[model samples]
Target: MLSESKKFRFAEDEEVTKKLFEEGDTDGDGLLTYEEALKAFSKYQRPFSREVFENYDTNHDGKLSQEEPETHSFRIINKYHFCGVFQFSNVVSLSHKQLRSISFFILAWQLLICDIMSVLVQFLLVIPQTFAGYSLYSHTFSYAIGSLDTLSYNGALMFALLLTINRLCIFLFPAIDQRVFGRPIIYGVVSLAWTLLFVFFIGLNATRCYKTFSVQGFYLHYENCENNSSSIGVIFQGIKDKWGRFSTYVMLGIYTLITIWLKFANRLHIKMNKTDGKQVRTNKKEIMFFVQSFIICITFLLESLMFDSIPRFKVYGQWRYAVNFTSNCITIFMFTVHSVVIFTFNSRIKEQLKEIFASKGKYYFASVTQTYPLQTTIVVRK
Candidate 1:
């Protein structure tokens, strides 16, 4: 029951309630019939069918009193509020744009560069070497071409590390994310990673090139590129193979550990009542990042395994050609697809792509439906 003082406080509300009741009482019988209530509600932009009105009647009375109207209003308000709560509770925000602190542009640029390099290596080197004669390039070009597979894997591993680090800063150490994980810092880290990769792998390749040229007085032979019969060549080959695989596995292991820890921490945060909607949303984004990382790692791993399984000189004739073609296709596909997937994960990039296509589509439609003015020449003879 509303007390007199409370009613006085809600006097304006009561007046509006009275107006609504009068509007619903179409026959002016001081009660709302089903049709009258439905019409009144529809005017207010609220859905109220006969069945809904019947539910509000409650006593099977065919008409609703003022008190019944107030009760129905309360029930409807509560029902919508309950639904809103459920929606909020189940919401999972996975938009990468929300993680703005992570430099998506930098990540995207790195992926793009790697993808372009993969394509160039495929067309300019891999295909020509496999199908056309392999005699066009000297030993240096051959060595660089062979090393591209390693470079692509390293590039992907670097990207995965960068993403993992960004997520760690955002979710675990958010207080310092702005200062510590700024764009400049991210840029420096990525630059340093590439520089180190070049110095180590490219430098090693250069050393091998020098050794082959100095000893054999010619470019490294495809038949015995490693010069594996010699002890020093065997050591160098062992180092090259072991280092490439070791670095990739180490990075993957670290990424896996970080992902597991993040999952555990997120669950614990929820259990401890420390998680809010924003935190939950961030967790969802992190999970999506983890999924993307997993895909990248798996694809790169498969490509690397395929490359290692096929020996350039050991296999003969059609089988060697087939293996080379298959491996090159798989490697190029993985790099290209990985870059595309990374771009799609960013909401801003996705929106831009959508807008570009939409504009083009509209233009195409207009061109197809265009009407041109017909020229009519009036005869001067008239």
Candidate 2:
């Protein structure tokens, strides 16, 4: 006769466990012994339960009960870990939210610095013009000056787009991102993006090849050779023109669509749950953050296009300088504003930042998503 005593099963806690046992216990053995359970768990790298085996052995038997018992406290799976936080106590630990926040800041700094540096180089190139040394300026500064500005602009755009992709992963695919970038992969990607940018832009397009047709002989209008073009130079310039414009437009278009969807969805979510003021507010803020990012991305691209397109409109001399300087300042200012998007939209990030600064202890990692058990029940029957 079957004993009417207590029966236990870890299978009660999770359905998958029950299925595994049903499948693995092939000989119609109603229960898994300690060794059997250990063997099953050994198949996976996860922990096995010695306690489960003993608990199932209710009759002081060496084997488990025919029926299973529920087990509590399963392993905590998928914990987020920041690189260097564990080993380097001096460095600040970044939670997922904080990492998103800091990524925004890094992108902003890249744009701000690149725009300023490029403009400074442009300004220096023009300094010789102020002292009646136009020949000297045109001879020495012509190639290097334009090349540097183009390189800086391209480098900043490439970096910012890569960062945008990172943000997208953080918001959309947090789990996969945590699994993939949980190691030093993030640093590796950043380095690779920058190196690719340098190789494609600065290294490839260092020569002045793009020719601007200018009338050298006043009144008569005679066409003169203004630039040198090597075989590699033409290829590089062609690639830069084509790829740069295409990438800028592609990024701008994708982000604009994303922002639109987020905005509509947020509005619908808020409308459906007016009573939940916090959720509504959060949704509104998230929508705004994404919209702001989209706008900034578009503005950055448009600004670059406008600067490059200015010469085509017959705009030249001090007017160009003024436009260039003003554009540089505007881009830098926009970058600074872009840096605050994550902070403004994400309260959790603000909280983590506060904790990071306030604490004397180790840096805290914040979870982007937390799981809540909807229900739990304990049944004791004898």
Candidate 3:
């Protein structure tokens, strides 16, 4: 079964199989083969996204009614990120003091910063323009917004790949992990990646390749150039597609090996521990952490494909907006679910999150999706 709000409809179609992203293996044996696991992610993803949009619409009018987007979800996720960050401090918890020092935790911290930058673009530019109406001042300021958005987004993808590799190495090559992921070496690598990412986007910014609202005016346009067919546009798109494909394949590849190892290890341990076959046992904290990270990568992969494919599918008018909204849902879901998993896996965070939701107008990583009053009339933008 999938998690809350992610329960997928089962279908036998080939397309469904191709887009699959089942949560847990449905087998007497404790493992799901690669084919059975990720087969319906993109297929059912559309309708699942539609449901989310409905939850936001409130009036079922197929439009955003809020002045600011992602406010509730963003606050919840930010709180979780900050909690995880402070987990490393002795002042917060002596047991977690080493978290900030670890390379994995440091990379996670950087990814948090990148997410904030992406949210700033949404908070300042995209949401307001789409809701309140675009302004001359916003148009002029968008250059900087576009630049930061690109830098932060690509930075996130890079750091995610790094985190995946770091996790894999810790399992398979402890010595290499220690040597390569040492504090100085890890910081150096992250710095170099950042420098290269900035230089690349800076070159595109120089060529005047930037962004705009999408045709349906939902999400920000991926790339804006003199004309969509310009060489710079092609390069920008090519990089997006290739980078997306590479990250998906690498995450899938690394985890396949890890899954095999875990299965073998579990088999060996089961013989010694002697457990019942009927229990839906929770995973160890270490295993749970890895599983959560893998899920994040899967969500990112699906989100990228979902957004890119929207334009290509020739969706139009209101339905096009729905597709774009679905893409945004996936983007928020990816980040929001990360925080959810953190609190789920960590007792300290979980307790605080529980307390947060217990209070009125408060939330934790567990989504308290915000709602607002809406106008009865539908205002369609031409």
Considering only N, C-alpha and C atoms within 3 Å, which residue pairs clash in candidate 2? 8-68, 8-69, 9-68, 9-69, 9-70
My TM-score estimates for the predictions, one after another, are: 0.54, 0.46, 0.60
Q: After superposition, how far is residue 9 of candidate 2 from its true place, in Å?
A: 94
lDDT tens digits by residue: candidate 3, 123-191: 666655443332323445776776677777777788878878887876677698888888788888888
Candidate 3 local Cα displacement, residue 125, angstroms: 0.4
Worst 10-residue stretch by lDDT in candidate 2?
213-222
lDDT tens digits, residue span 1-382, model 2 = 1223323334334465666566546567686667776776677544445543543454445665445322111101001111112211221233333453344444544554555545454345433322221123343445556556556667767766765564455555668656544455655666686687777655454564422111110000001112536776667666766765766777776676565655585456536444587766754654455555565566667766865785477433223334444554444443333334444555665677668677634322122112222221111221
Q: Which residue pairs of candidate 1 clash? A: none
TM-score of 1: 0.54
Cα lDDT of model 1 by residue, 1-382, tens digit: 1111111110125675466667778787777877777777677775345544543453457777765311111112222323332222221122234443556445645655565554555455544432321134665666667566456555765665565556556656766666655767776777887897676556445446321111101111223434444665565556655654654565566566767777696676555356688867866776677666656556656655665666544643233334443654565556555545665565765565567679999887566545432211222233
**Best-first order by lDDT:** 3, 1, 2
Question: Which runs in model 2 stand beyond 4 Å of their true positions?
Answer: 1-101, 127-142, 175-184, 205-231, 266-292, 304-382
